[model samples]
Target: MLYQNFSKTPVLAAAATSLLLLLLLSSTAHAEAPMAANEATEVVISASRIEMARESSGSAITVLDSDYLEQNQVQVVSDVLRDVPGVAVSRTGGAGAPTQVRIRGAEANQTLVLIDGIEVNDVASGSEFNFAHLMNLEVERIEVLRGAQSALWGSDAMGGVINIVTKRGKGSLNGKITVEGGSYDTHQETLAINAGTDDYHYALSGTLLNTNGISAASEERGNREKDGYKNATINLKSGIDLLDNLSMDLVVRHVKSDVDTDSFLGGVGAVDSDDNTETEQTSGKVSAKLDLLDEQWHHRLSFSANDTDNTFFTAGTESYNSQGYKQKYEYQTDLFLYSSLTNSDDLEHRFTFAAEHEEEEFYNKGFSTIDRDMDVSGYVVEYGANIDDRYYATVAGRRDINSLFQNANTYRLTFAGWVTDSVRLHTSKGKGIKNPTLFELFGSTPDYTGNADLRPEENSTWDVGTEYHFNALDGYVDLTYFHTDVTNLITGSGQTSVNMPSDAKIKGVELSLVLRPSDNTRLNSSYTYTDSNDGNGNELVRRPEHVASINGSYLFSNDQTRLTTGVQYNGKQDDIEYDANWNTSTVTLSDYTLVNVALTHQLNKHIELFGRVDNLLNEEYEEVLTYGTKGINGMVGITITGSL
Candidate 1:
């Protein structure tokens, strides 16, 4: 009966299709090159917490520039990540059913999300950030690190890291405004403004979104509801020139969102939900970078705090509230020299040292949930040296102490060599760990209990890779193979336990290529093959066996108009089987492929028109076995800008 209650909606579909057709018909098409110029050979900055050439490291990393974000007309940060290799994004129930992102077989808590060099992962839930309510209008670029980095960032670096850089002031006061509407009564709006002066610079942005829930299941009528969500963000950054060589910068950011949904367990109907949840957050950080020490030495000091308060009530029932908060502090120093040991062969050396501390607390009322409080402190030391521009090596070590764990030690070794001007090879190995969060130790409902005796998960990983860059043609390709083994996995039964036989392993390969033929058209493609399993040979839930994506865009050399299309494939997965109400069952999740298309036209100097189509085939699929995903959808938007 649950699967037999699917509903059909066509008006929204028709509007989305019409908008796409009109935009495409009005634009001129062009041929795409095998790769994009400069894109394929671009170096990433997130891998080592600093800028470095892609081929100069053993790890795998991906870069997403602003052009890709604009062509897709995406309003949320999560939407922009769909094309990353080995990364999967899923949304359940509706726009706010709690989104989840998995990378390379790692669980949600294993991955780390950074916004402008700041960690955004929730310590209470020990979960990767959903980014469901984060607006993309403020993003300048995105860098993804695809391997373990615990030696540098401490726990939660086992899965990898995604760093988002915010837009900065360039030459003038730049800003834009975007508004969009589509099916399921979805709508979005965003605004950004930035400016700079000889002595001061700053940028500010805000965004809002609303949508009606789609069908939760094939035939469920009432399961499909509506969500009214609001997100507000304010960022202020300023820099002051103190002396000829010294400057200071201050950054402050605050974000908050509210989500409303229907409760399926409280009632059975086609258009109502009795359950409600609201999540709100306020976070801010201040950092200062000092270059006055010397031309070769730099110093940075920063402090940040994040406070989250969440509440849940069933069917107009009031009596429960939950809260979570985290505070972090960091200091770093770096020394760069053109010639360290000697001035011969144009050799160079760099050294870095950093210290950090964090405090996290969780509290809940009106339910059987455990309250958690933790304090963590860590330090890192690293050194890198390059000789004759042909050989390089890096060594790093870290030590972390937490209230829950005595001390965790990690280390990394990296080597790179250039056999030829066009080819390079690299290798790296590192140790990492993921610590337990508050929710895992003490969250409760009618069916679950917390485990307080859990230990941190530990892992060691190694990666090898090669890159060939034909800079002459602005083309490049890279391939990497990685393996990770984890132990002391934490799980719940009557209580939490640290078990070695419960460990897991993951092996994977990644390939990325980019080409630019004539400077106006660009093509980028990536593919991943992964095998992940537990000691008992059970497949990890929610992870696809393989993933592939290709994105192509065309624009007139003048950069006035552009069109883009992409395709993604998520392989089939084994379902989760467990005892629910004394019965056990299994469900096989079907694999699915999706296509997306988008077009943008610069209609003069002050306005732009854009449209996009999602799930082109109207395919129905689930991200979490029996969970739900949105069906075919489309949206049309307009952006306006002004300069003074």
Candidate 2:
């Protein structure tokens, strides 16, 4: 009995290595074709509250599908999490630059970006979220949720949670269009549509991207003073089922981007070059579900709104603009119970309760402008259990109150066990918080000064895992280990009214695998080992201790053409450390391993043809901290789907 009523240890070393990897994956299932059953797809289970997969453990999860984002035409969501497994992405300019990402090791406003489930984090950068004005055109899937979720979302989430789910209405009118161009002058365009009418459903998407960056320090000729970027996006969604238990859904999104850098001149005067940065955002949401006094009692309601604007230019020393707004309301309930206590067998339990209210406002202008407003309230309760299919348990708690600062509490505990039927085991622990951003407390002008006494940044996390599934073959595997400890941790001493204090620690180990090995071919691999330390030992800049990725896919004729390839590695790092007065020199950055390939052809069921090649050994990297990251590129596209 796995995890039967908390932990008492058992599970015989993960059930004898999952029966020896399911007998080494049953001699390779005739070489391919399987995994196509699961209620015909469509899973959005936000971690422990139900819905499970990715082998299921309790923490550490990653999922990206939509034919792998249309066979890698990925235009955001940070390029599909850049091979997951302890993600980290950085960019300074190309497709509208200003992109930064992090997970596991946290930092990037401590991770927490959501769409559909709302919360886009960014009210004067309290937890960073620009996402270059969002663009992934009506996504259909993307869920990371690695660690410390504050019991179901609260504050910055302390480092993990990316949920983004879009696209509804399945069956009937479908659509697609794509275009691409390569080599520093890159160009892209996309459009999508989906519709249904059994009770009303809809989806819409639009995208446009432009690039022109290359050299920042390569003898400076890859496009001198490169400055050229642009982006645009629009998304809309709808749903209605009017009766039969009542239902409704709606969403709207908009984005704009622009960037042209060249500032902070040390050579002085005239060389100040050009500078312009702009961003605009809009968001809306509404949700309702009811079945009042039946089916275990159900009721759900939601409302949301978000608006953002940012502008920066320096042609004459002072030009800045900032604006932000947010509003939210929510309610939830669901309960089901039946227990007999006494460990080891099956019982029953499912309970949930939720309530939330939020409001935020901000304003700024020029060299410095300030104004503030905030209100937040929260509550959550959960319990889940299963004693007989091999054991499982969950407990959750959360409480939040804020008018400005301090007032947080979070808790979570989870256990899982299977021991047989393919093995399973899980463990989780949590606590989280983050708050402080409104330009870090007034001052976006006035020469920068506004700290209205700030405080609020804490975290604690622990996770352990194991998973193995093989109904005789079809392969699957997972392994996880995590630890996080953060306190205070907020920095911004690059000038402007200074501020500092950072204490951090992150531990990690992750490995995942998928294998078909033969009916055509498929093999995936992942590995990550991180230490991320900086509580005085110095050295946590541009982190990278080890990272790996491997991917392969193959399918032919009778199965309709397919080919995929991947290889990524990052190791050497330390972009800047040693600050006598403030980093008095000591920079090292040497680490590169890039290879990517993709090809798809199906010209049959409605046309298809694709191609991709990026940094295919054309290595020359720099993920930020001096910018510049590009070399070797290629793209080809074609797509068409039908059914009207």
Which candidate achieves the best lDDT against the true structure?
Answer: 1
lDDT of 1 by residue, 1-644 (tens): 11111122222233344335434532332222111113444567666655676655666777887877877776676776767876867665556666777777777678888777667776545445766656675777888776678888878787788878787665588888889999778888888888887766777777777776564432334244455555666666556666666667666667766666543321221234465667776666777766522345556667677776667766657546667777776766655555435556755666677777777787766455557687777878888776766787889898888888779899888888888988888888888888877766665543345666777888878888888876775777878888888887664343232444677898898787877765788888888888888777877666777878888889976688888888888778765544433233345578888888898889999999989898889887777543456778999999899875
lDDT of 2 by residue, 402-430 (tens): 88876888887777787887778877888
**Reference-based TM-score, model 1:** 0.87
Question: For every model in order, what is the number of clashing pairs?
Answer: 14, 9
Instruction: Report how far residue 275 has shifted in candidate 2, in Å.
Output: 7.4
Go through the candidates in order and give the C-alpha RMSD of each one to the true structure: 13.4, 23.4
Tell me how far the alpha carbon of residue 329 in candidate 2 is from the true structure, in angstroms, after superposition: 40
Please state the error at residue 578 of candidate 2 in Å.
Answer: 45
